[model samples]
Target: MEHSSVHHPEMPHIPSTLTLASRTPTVGSARKSETRHILVIYVGGTLGMKPNSENSLAPVAGYLTTEMRRMRELNPPSDDFAQQGSSSSSNSFSSAALSNEMRVPTFDVIEYAQLLDSSDMDQQDWLVIARDIERYYYLYDGFLIAHGTDTMHYTATALSFLLHNLAKPVILTGAMVPLMEPYNDARRNLVVGMMFAASTEICEVCIFCNDVLLRGNRSVKVRHTLSAFSSPNYPALSVMEAQPFRPRRHLLARPPTGPLAIHSDMSGRVMTVLCHPDFDAESVKTMIQGTSKEAESRLDCVVLELMGVGNTTSTMARTLQSVVNTASRVGCLVAITTQDLYGSLTAASVSRLKKSCPDAIFVGDMTTEAAAVKAMYLFGKKLTAAEVKEWMPRNIRGEVTTVASRL
Candidate 1:
């Protein structure tokens, strides 16, 4: 089923909104319970970027699948290739890889009609991917997303929230280098991610890169290197060396018993402000008070990116409480998170912020990427301001660590 998003006039291909076909009921199809048929959703990124006319790296249509099909390890030539009669050229080609290896599962690719640079993705793109999984939920055993590294963390976090009670692995992967280039990391990332996606033991959104598996919401792109992501506050759920066992201990204990739930209401708007010496409450007041009549433009939450100790400047402290009171009245949420990558907010700082902004949420140890998407998820689900605070500290998706500290 082909689906197209609402396109922008200037950027015709990149849609401002996406629409997916209605979900179909799971008719007792011929999907073998024991078989691993992974569905790979390829949303373009650096993994498939090729040099174009200006000699600048850009995503080319049909470039990814063309390059990927040549990987013998993924689509290995089988001796039984003669079994498929005349249709062997296309039919046998797909089946041959099915018997490739136990670790190498058969997969079908659904390339987006308009390949998006990861930077071009929006909340609607996340919703489209979630609905895609729902539409084909009954057909495939697992889902793997090929995304750009730039905003992979955001999409991964959004998916973690949008797709609830997931019963299969949803692994997102992309390389710093494009697959068309020699000596690139795309193959290793893709192959390993495929294996994980095919595994029945893992049942949550995760990012597999640089030989390690990090929880989707817990991950962040640390640098512009092959080692793209890191789970700073938590240990990796699985590593290449400890796979098939490490996940057993560190990952979600077991797949959820309930049927998978998909939440498409990620319409929440949020803003991030770094607390500097110039940080002031007046600007934040304007934001929470509703800057525009456009519902989509208005913010539902504001993430206060605080210092290492989670405290802001005295400049902003002057009218912080009053602004917070306005936020509470207008149904806006105030979230506090530390700037440190590895360290979480302290109890003393959290208490102080909580005292000042009674309705403020102390996002403990959550990466800014995770925090931002989480706010969008919460508001998009139509949660009340009180509910946002209620859910903020709780570990709904393994994104935050509940730290107990003294003032």
Candidate 2:
């Protein structure tokens, strides 16, 4: 991946309303916040990508505004769309051009001056989104993130852990295909996501795409289809057809009582190791306990992606015990998660894993993505090793399901 400074020099670290409502495709001002008002943070993604002079598709800053104006569903104007340089900012982006069933919201769109592919995103990039939401927490009733699909689930999971005490909607969305194409789900998904923000009380981080609403931490990128994401170990929060979302209220996350806060501190030292038939104990040892040159080898945490029910080779397990023991002595957490999509670690699995590696934290049913971010979030909070272990398996952000509930 290219360096972030080379790509994102123009995107504001502290978000400012850059696209003017009067001369741009936006509908409202950042300074004004009211009930039913939505804020769209257009973090560069394929939805806004356009053919560069080289004919290769690339994210072009402010291009989404152009396409949105052309779509009568968002601008609702019959005029020459390209000539709408000074269109009214009081306009609404709604389902009118498509349908009248979904709620129409007055919204403001903010774009990064320099667009970067989400594949290059890191903890710092995730921090930017979290901080922006924190600054504008009280301004809008809900939030929408127009992001790239490559890492959309990762961002959703990171945000779920980074933003604490969330009491309003924070929906992440992106298009499988670009809006510049003759036909795509770009406009459709955006309309539906905005409608959810305007009409629902889903008071936590969520991902909405291809008519599927999923808990952010519970979501996974399943395939290249229109619905590229799924909550493999969990249930869909909502599934909308011709009508608006009839969310399973019981599945929705309840809002916390305290005011919203962002956790800015995070340790990127965590690593993910996958267990396989050829999983070498030497490589695992080298990973968990760094070389002699780098003495402090126990990273902040290590996510062990094991086979079904958190099983591993008897030989590898015995070999890993020594390294895990070393990492455990120095405050490094070892979280165990299953490689199977629907797999949940059982008590027997935990018991067996404990015998092999005494310092393992059983992370039942939480997707590998969730486990990784949860580790960084917990470590970022400066939590002690014991506290991190205590919280790893507990359902903090609806990421993990109860074994009893599954039964």
Q: Count the backbone clashes (under 3 Å) in each candidate.
A: 0, 0
Output the number of the TM-score-best candidate: 2
lDDT for model 2, please.
0.73
Off by over 4 Å in 2: 1-17, 20-35, 76-101, 292-298, 309-313, 403-407
Taking all chains together, the TM-score of candidate 2 against the true structure is: 0.84
Q: TM-scores of all models?
A: 0.82, 0.84
lDDT of 1: 0.73
Model 2 per-residue lDDT at 379: 77
lDDT for each residue of candidate 2 in 83-190, tens digit (9 for 90 to 100): 223344333542323322254465667777767788989887888888878876775678889999989999999998888888888999999888888898888888
TM-score of candidate 1 to 2 decimals: 0.82
Can you write out model 1's per-residue Cα lDDT over 169-214, one digit (the tens) per residue? 8999999988878899988898888888887777889999988888
In model 1, the Cα lDDT at residue 87 comes to 33
